[model samples]
Target: MPSNAPASADNWWCDESSEYAFMGFSYEVTACQSPQQLQQDFADIRNTFNGRYIRMYGACDNDGFYDDVVNAAWDNGIGVHALIWFGFDGGNQWQQRRDSLVSTLYSNPKAKFVTRGIQFGSEPLFDGVLSPNDLASQIWDLKGQVKSLGIPVTVSELAYGYQSNGGAQNVLDAQDYLNIHMLPFFDATASTSNDAWPIVQNNLQFFQENGGGKKMYFDENGWPSVTSEGVQANSGAAVADVTNEAGYYQLLEDHCSDLKNNAQGGIGWFAHIYSDSQEPGYGIYDTNGNKKFNFAPRTYC
Candidate 1:
């Protein structure tokens, strides 16, 4: 079948061979999968997606081992944005548990080489898990401990979280560079992927200014291909179809010049996910590891 994007399949493949095509992808560690399976997944992250980095949503499996994940990523020649997973500020156990993993990886020779930085938390303000000041202080303290390891620290939040008055201003102030989410498909103004670029352009300046003039990236950009029932889904006409997903990514390819140049104080982009077979249809690769679209990001249009 043909795609709905402006370009045909033959013209859709971007210059993914460029290291600046995309900074990284978001991935998780599954205990059910064997070490070999995880290794292949990391290989795909580097080779297939041309990702230089990855933000892991998971760390340890049942035996409390995180080395497999760290080693796979590093061995695959991809840097890792290690997660500290601070959900709902209940106590210090979450921090302490992750502390053990960092301590272990700290000794690995690859730690300094492939560990990009430690993402202290993901959308804590959006989830109401921590106050801006609290999360900022936590980022401060984490950087303090991990300085010898030579890892920077940051937190992810929605663009609105950086509101100047009472929002997560401190969180923005604490991060080394801004890591924010700006998903256009969720906006009512976006009827389809073709409509998404305008939304991104309209918001980029606001996001940049509110972000305090630091380097930034849209870490959770995504669009679904379909609904869970295997039918088309719609959010004000942002239809969940493979073609729409292709169209959304087409914009990514067209806009990569800015990222590659690091122009206007931007760093890179990491799409929402690599593969999600369960629901909401945002996976580029399906459960059987088949890529749904013949798409890649280019450094220029």
Candidate 2:
């Protein structure tokens, strides 16, 4: 994919190995697979994808499964944005979580090097778990302790959540980057596939201004490849099909130039997931190990 914009090396977000952004995993759910199975899956991803970054959910607990995840990621030459899950307001449990996470990191210093960033929580506000001010204070306090470790930290929220007037503006004010999930297919207006990029572009501008001059990343974005029998319901809207799902990937490859150009404000856009799982819908690979039409082969542009 040749680009009208400067080369990938000139783009700030480009990794030495690939032009694509990070990959994501539903770790809290998927890591439950057998260690051998998970290791193989990790190996397959490293051998196939050009990108070196990955995003994972949940802390390093639950029988040390996340420890295996981190070890496998390091073994396969990938970095991770590890998340600490939050449900409701935790009172004293918040400090306990911070302590546990710190202990995990302390125990696995080698694996910790592979951690690209620390995500406090994923869509905490959307789930009505905490107010923006509460979330921001949490993020700021965590950053105070962890920032000295030399990695960026932030939270993930829906696209509009990064806006100046949105409930998560305080969270936006606390992080180093504008980390957002841009899912146009789920928008109430319910646009077609072709409208996805334009929707993304428009949201980026909104986020850029409201993010307090911080850089941004589409930490999660992609349409579900399943149709008919397996359509994942979107807050009660019609299910997205292959037409929209596959088109989303092609649209990304076709506009790689615009994506890398700093004129658009240099954003890193990660695909929603790596492989199929019990979660259903968004995987670029089926549970049978087949690639979906939306599986674009990423490479240095």
Candidate 3:
């Protein structure tokens, strides 16, 4: 995922006074050519989608990927929710990550203008690499450092994780907000694209009921058009893919239209992505920046 700098509601999708307060997307830069290209992409995303926020999955690396994203986002009036990678890195690695973040903020005098908040990691508990208590501790520890930089801190996890005993007592209590990744596609029980909202609604209910009613932010959600080999063999193959561009289009339209008004009652959502990637068939934009036939609903674009 990636970002754009913060802008007034006038510049974003939803009206400032509207009940629908947030509309955002996740971005990745693997298909970008240079910083200039990446910057233009951010500008295009803002101009085209009217999205105010972008979520990046991990910390900046020596390769300058995160650097390009931050610079582009700041220039294009987008807010970024940065996530730090914390699988098994040691204390030194964590310090380095912190240094990189602090440096990014310090170097950008106007960082407060574009920064939304921070997440300690994406799906640490869902992946089973970290226990619920461990994720809670990370959030508790990192919250101070993030606050020192003038940003809020939280962790992104599968919505179901929060329903667990530890999730309710530990994880929910440690974070400033709830950042959940709700991909019903991964659920064996989900039988169709239409099955998505019900799962999303249920998860939101779980968060609201067990989470002490913290604000909700869906870090990821979307349907893939093609059933590539990896996902094709999954248990829900019967409804895994929408099968064609038109079906995929309707799926997006229905999902977005319904979600805009908190239709399913989740406060807000970030569409799964901006463009296609190695993950296959999820991009709204092709590698050359061309919109797929069903990229977005007509009015949305």
Candidate 4:
């Protein structure tokens, strides 16, 4: 019973015995925050929220940023959904990001344990910053480098981006799993409605139809509670009512069991964000560290 091996891939989501194997939240890095700061947050994500994954969005300029995250992540008993953000404007840091990612995997034995998987690019094709084949090639290249590490790899993109891009299917084939962004707040029909669950279902339907049945998961999905200090969200009939935020998350919490048990192999979702400071009003906790609601997320439904 005491034999030593990780309970999952790179300790993937969480140990098999974990109560929170299916929950996660999106974590963004605008700058190179200290490991102390990052560890504190990671501790909260794992201990307080019982989250098994943290989907990364952006990164600091430092080449060491990747490993910094990895080391801190495992230390807190949480795993990192490593994202080598290509950025929206498509700046030219391909070499840097590549090097950092590879090095991080090799730098520490804990690196792979903390890594949930590697997302080589995030929404790169949506803005035409990268071609489908080009993105796929990058994904394969990274896969080769990390073959020994055995980390699952993917390139995140919108459902439409995958549907419309000429070689999108190729990119989909290249990755080990489907990494898609499903945000109801952007949907015209859902954004204005009191109930976003229906639209969220539609979003998942879109992915599954084109997915060819590959395992899929949402890297981002949630509703913003506010657009500004006084301004409410303005997506047609949508207002700034803070209750809407809880509604979206509540649905996610409710269906966690269905997602894991689905025969189609859905990997579950990571909430859109962690705190309001990073994103105006999308956080579970506001700027003052007060929760918008009293409910907690449960991955097992």
- 1-301 in candidate 1: lDDT tens per residue? 1212122123322223333446767775533456787679779877876777776664353443456666676568777777776555556656775676567556555565556667776666766667777778988887788777656677766665555337566777787766667677766676888778877776576655666666666666677776665333335566777898878877777777755554343457776677774224777788777888885765233
True lDDT of residue 60, candidate 2: 40
Cα shift from native, residue 130, model 3 (Å)? 2.5
Order the numbered candidates by TM-score, best leading.
4, 1, 2, 3
Q: Which one is best on lDDT?
A: 4
Error of 1 at 289 (Å): 1.7
| Worst 10-residue lDDT window, candidate 4 | 12-21
Best by TM-score: 4
Which residue pairs clash in candidate 2?
A: none
Give all candidates' CA lDDT scores. Answer: 0.65, 0.63, 0.62, 0.72
- List candidate 3 stretches off by more than 4 Å: 1-22, 30-33, 58-60, 63-65, 87-95, 163-168, 229-234, 242-266, 295-301
Which residue pairs show backbone clashes in model 3?
A: 1-27, 1-56, 2-27, 4-78, 5-73, 5-77, 5-78, 5-79, 6-78, 276-283
Clashes of each: 2, 0, 10, 1
State residue 124's C-alpha deviation in candidate 3, in Å.
0.4
- Estimate the overall C-alpha local distance difference test score of candidate 3: 0.62
Worst 10-residue stretch by lDDT in candidate 3?
8-17
Residues 169-242, model 2: lDDT tens digits: 66777887656777777765555666667777776666666777666667767777564453444545534776
